[model samples]
Target chain A: MATAEERSRLRDVPIPAIGGVRWLLGLVVPALLVVVWHLLVTTGVFAAHQLPEPLRVVGTLYAMGVAGDLWGHVAITLQRVFFGVLLGVAVGTGLGTLTGLSGLASDLLDPLLQSLKNIPSLAWVPLFLLWFGIGEGAKVLLIAVGAFFPVYLNLSTGIGEVSEDLLEVAEVYDLGRVEALRTVVFPAALPSLLVGIRGGVGLAWMFVVAAELIAASQGIGFLLSDGRVLARPDVIVGSILLFAFLGNLSDLAVKGVQRRVVDW
Target chain B: MADAPSEPTLSVRGLTKRYGDTVALADVDLAVRGGEFVAVVGPSGCGKSTLLRVLSGLEDRFEGRAAVDGDDVREGGSDAVGMVFQEPRLLPWTDVRGNVAVGLPADVDAADPDARARIDELIRIVGLGGFAERRPAELSGGMKQRVSLARGLAYDPSVLLLDEPFSALDRLTKHEQQDHLSDACAERGTTVVLVTHDVEEAAYLADRVVVLGDQPGRVETVVDVDADRPRERTDEDLLAVRARIVEALGV
Candidate 1:
């Protein structure tokens, strides 16, 4: 207790030793994969038509950016995802909270949602195209439908799993229904809600790709389709890479929000 | 100090609770006057917690007449009672101040200067003045329980129900909490009903100790402590009362 060095160590918060090195370590695998890809292309392991060189894909990405096409497509796709996720979160959270809190609501709604969520997202594309006519509505609805189930399922499960002890505390405090929902139920279910949002965001990205594949004028999904028709592997590969990057970025954003909101 | 006679702050008569075929409590009666400190001590299965729950109006299915200051316990709202559970049961997401402030009425403005001052006072009373910004996860078990006690007192309840509030703590911390609770309640003149298994705790803190027996839990005996406050733990009279409680517990 009297040691100066030990006291200083205790007073100073120890920085994680691996923090800086871990970022470098993480790049190693991707770097190795890119190297292998370049080698395969240089050695002509696959035909040029089948697989474009990595440099060609980079050239295509640069050209798209110069033409302002990349930003336009990215913006449209992001808009669709944003609105779809917002709508899905609102509806799913509302319904999930209702069903979670009320036995009668659960009895009436759970079986239908359970059955509906099983249908693949692609299965709805035909109906959505027919209903909304390949417009913004069809694409947004598809993503929303894809995003709704996970948020609903996880939120309901999380709410149902709130500790009985805490619920008793709410009772003792005589918290009104809304007050309890805001203060007790919401915080208790936040971690699960964040998990649900993460799942929903992933599905939203996937659904956007599917939605664009069916019919779209401007989007990364349209790039994939246009590349297939024109036999340009570069565009296809570049679009796929952009999707991966954006998806990672969106998921990272969700994680950042989760860290800030659900500290416990 | 003559005043108009008033009803007991907490009263339960012929309280009976059953879960299907199992009776948790049967034909139990208890009364606690305003500012009185009563401790309920008994064996593990003696339904001490159930009684507290009934008195706190959390358990409504019990067949009994339980009231706080002439109002039916169930009808009296948050102002009637505050309860501290065995576990701290603080919202882990909230800091100490937020947790304690949750005990206040919803209509109260959290940002009001007076409200903030009262919250600070309660936190100081519980000896958590410096830790108001700490989350429950950041605190030790004893500290968390202190926050829980502060939250209970924040309501300024006429009757405070404690269900083994210090049972999870170590011996030293438990005694410390006991003293803190006694002082806090004495300062506020709030009636308290504490449920615990420790005979010594019951003897040291309670003005009256009610012993209960198991099987369909019922009151076994009630012992009154005539000793003064701040009495030493080793005081002969307190020890004798503790011994009688231990004997009543059939230990």
Candidate 2:
């Protein structure tokens, strides 16, 4: 297991470098919001039941952490998103490449995919529930469905837009079909594919919450619903903030990978 | 080095190519003997590039025959043919050495020690010695084209087809590349067919210059340069040949 300092370095948080005025600029808005939140609570601008004090939410988070409930919910939510996004990327990339390379595949599949893309993630929840039941299957598939379209659209378009000059070079070299696709087509399309994966991962996080809200019993989304039943405003708002943090972290990870891989 | 042949290394007879309703080349005939340097010169729409494409086996839709070393080009004799396009066309993801290695024949063993040495030698020949690990984006345009030239020569092809490879460079860079190309090709004794619009370049580099006319592109004239190797740019013989090529091009 990594020590605390090593974990922080691995996360690349740059805490010691955050003392500058430039770094403090990012904290201004949150500070102002906190002051306003405190004023509202102390002045009784709204009922205490409707909007709890910010410190109360922090205390509630501490209580949940001490009880070991927070980590379990966070872990379960991350696991679902990971598996869903992986499966979605695999299927999307496969279909996208097939359609991009063959006119017949494009003609047969593009219309159906475009129509399916019009439906919102919430709209698919009912159908998925009916097809796969309210078990983990329906939730995972819902997240996958949400993640699929952006990857499909971006990858297909990227493959189609590879330079004709490079393709002609491949012909002159007499590279076989498989070799041409591997060397010429794939690398040329990589930047756009990275863009697709970033968007897909974002959608995966969004759909996970909706999936859990419908039928999940043990996830961050379930915590929100459970807090609602118990009339705990702090738990609901804390869950939303946690989701925001996790989503931003995932995006940063993807950007880091993109920078390292697509150096050209 | 292989023995030089007495017969023509590249032979094109009654070649014709048409795209849709436009005739790119019509009944053109040319031949380049073994180890000879030939340049095809013409005005903007005269199908010089198309002819090179046909000879290099990139275009197989032509009506007549083009052969390299007695084998029909259209039957996929890519191992015998190497091409340098107007642009470098280097894969951006690959470095200089990697780009040169891409030209090796499919059967060549990349893991073999000799193949790796050959790739390094080609890079050195192109004056990209210490920069083998640098990507194309880090190199200047002339440097990138040098990498392209090295790639064309990497596999020790029997024939090299260059489609205005130096036209994109400035004057000094073009002159330097021309000298580099002449020296490299002379050392290898590889048959070369270069397509250019510059008469002076054709006169200075090629053993014979074939001029093509536009509309239905066909051979107008073939001027032979009998000057010695490393001929001066202003030598009387090359000047006379350049003037004749300019007149034939009608420019």
Candidate 3:
């Protein structure tokens, strides 16, 4: 046999370019929305106190940034979401692995978790506040509760749905149950785990807002509520825009990691 | 190590498999000596793969004995065989080197600086030497199957079971992989049992071709290809043997 070999080397697949056109294209709608908002305010379609001019909102945020006050609020909120997502992911992974690998454990735990999944993030507020006394503990734990479900659900389903063919290969290779789970099952379930983490981060942002409502004094959420209390529409709109930007940034970071880690 | 000199490396006798009322295989029997290459070929639904499944310990519910080196392997504790399935089944999270290392013995340090050389050698044996860093998604279908083959060989198994492993490859790629497999098995002196549907593939690669009949698949005939190594595919004697295998298929 002529062992003359042909290696049909695959050139690297260019990752779908998240390039200038796509970036600029995404800006079109939000830019248009700001233009419409300027028109709505300048035309006096809505009263100034009710809906601030778009520039006024931008000016308020700029002023806050120059004063070095915006950083404190953004920093605290980011911290809360970070820790909450970490806690949520750690606990969710533990539980998801258990239920995913064992039918008896799934039967024992899945129903109760599924039922509690419906209890809105706000619904946990009363219980958490009463238990932890409206401190950072309560605030962070509330955000964790919100982040937990997506990780739990996605990871459980991902692990459970690991391909049987791969498992069969593990068996034929004589990978014992534990070794198979570690080598094959966990790696196979990683894409879904990452997807879950992305959702969990987004949820962390939402629940941080609810969490800061429990008497926070220095977060973007607190800024929004304070703006509402003092009736500063510009500050309120500025805070909302800040939330959108930070939440999207965090989501993009997780997605970037997903792309790299699950390249196959 | 304690085996009698007369014992076969892999043997299956009276092996029958069923799913409730549907019989997948019935009364199949075969034995392969060490370092031998055997291919089981038949029409679809002829349980060609079922025999492999039983031997690889994936179909443990079957009746009769599937043994490796004179010990029953059906009880699920056997570490004597490595199997390549129809699909690559590579872990998408890993590279070719890592996927092959997944089949290494549990004690072998796949992460060790020393063990990487052996893993790299396995990759080369499968014709994927330069592609070690490539991910499964970056590979062509034939390359992916080669990675799967490398993974099966990484176990350093006494017997290798392959279930239509090249069925998904193009004809030319399949031919190349068969030669790669033949060379690798020869180099390692490993026994091999392949299940395939292509008569030409069986004739070209296997020392013996076991033809199976359909519906409650049972062995029809086992044709010996008494040809030498590196035999020409178009050689008159090889063609005559190929004709015998096709005729045995009753087609």
- Predicted chain A of candidate 1: TM-score: 0.92
Give stretches of model 1 more than 4 Å off. A1-18, B1-7, B77-79, B168-176
lDDT of 2 by residue, A185-237 (tens): 99998888888889999999989999998888889999888889899989998
Q: What are the Cα lDDT values of the candidates?
A: 0.88, 0.87, 0.87
Ten-residue region with minimum lDDT total, candidate 3 chain A:
A6-15
RMSD of each: 5.0, 7.4, 7.3
Q: Each model's TM-score?
A: 0.91, 0.89, 0.90
Candidate 3, lDDT over the whole model: 0.87
Q: What TM value does the first chain of each candidate achieve?
A: 0.92, 0.88, 0.91
Model 3 chain B lDDT-worst window of ten: B70-79
Tell me the deviation in Å of residue B71 in model 2: 4.9
Q: Can you give the lDDT of residue A125 in candidate 1? A: 94
Q: How well is each residue in B149-234 modelled by candidate 3, as lDDT tens digits? A: 88888888879888888877887778788888888888888999999878888888889989998788999999998999997778
- Say which docking band candidate 3 falls in: medium
Give the alpha carbon lDDT tens digit for every residue of B7-39 in model 1.
567778899998788898999998788899999
Interface RMSD of each: 1.8, 1.6, 1.4
